[model samples]
Target: MEDLWQAFVNVDSAGNITGDYSGKNIVAEDPYDFFFLVDKEVALSLHEYKVHLDGFKPSLVPKQSAE
Candidate 1:
């Protein structure tokens, strides 16, 4: 996360805002929650969830799933 934060922002010996907005929502969001989706904390695996999502390809999930 620190490496990701460094990519979005830059600071010298003293801290300061030093990045371009470029229409990204970084200005209003908390960085701590930036990488997580809201449903990630839900109490079920994808197999147990009934909703049929269009783009949730299981073939690609293993590369990123910590579990």
Candidate 2:
């Protein structure tokens, strides 16, 4: 056993764990073996996603008839 590191794991495709894996402090040859790193800023908010708005209105309003 050595200094433990924390990371996120992709359960759908996980590798062999050091122990029974009680849901905490899992050991493995490499973090990439099971756990994966996720960029919160990128995944939560994509940088490539951008749109410019120019006050465009496409709604039609019915005009009231003068009495």
Candidate 3:
């Protein structure tokens, strides 16, 4: 028997996201369902690993010359 790996995204109750890699092989009874499962797992992982965006501002400002 061979082992397979799958990627997943975990979400917490606080709406936090995290990425995870599992070593479980999902046996899809239906061929069509196989792709769906894979996609769902991947999406979850991505959501978990989402990045945070902080406030940003432009630093380019015109300087006034003192008479």
Candidate 4:
């Protein structure tokens, strides 16, 4: 199995990214994917979002006991 992290562009009335771009990165998994979209007026801009995953949130199994 593969692990993954995810994020989405949070938009406001104007459709701009609601939060700062402090943590966002572009992924090359799929080029033609619609990662972002904005309406006219130029008031809104899509943001590339990303996340990091060191490992599963919690191990499925507990630490093995000494054999």
User: On residues 1-67, what C-alpha lDDT tens digit does candidate 4 reach at each position?
Assistant: 3222223333443333444221134353433212322222111222332222236331111112111
lDDT of residue 47 for candidate 2: 25
Ranking by TM-score: 3, 4, 1, 2
Candidate of highest TM-score: 3
What value does the lDDT take at residue 63 in candidate 1? 15
Per-model clash counts, in order, read 0, 0, 5, 0
Cα displacement (angstroms), candidate 2, residue 25, comes to 13
Ranking by lDDT: 3, 2, 4, 1
Candidate 3 residues 1-67, lDDT tens each? 3333444334343323433333356543322201212344443444333322234321111122111
Candidate 2 residue pairs that clash: none
Tell me the deviation in Å of residue 22 in model 3.
Answer: 5.2
In candidate 1, list every pair of residues with a backbone clash: none
Task: Report the error of model 4 at residue 5, Å.
Answer: 10
Model 1: runs farther than 4 Å from truth?
A: 1-7, 21-67
lDDT of 1: 0.25
Error of 4 at 28 (Å): 18
CA lDDT, candidate 1, residue 14: 24
TM-score of each: 0.18, 0.16, 0.22, 0.21
Could you give candidate 1's per-residue lDDT for residues 23-66 as a string of tens digits? Answer: 21334343421121223222123232222223643121221342
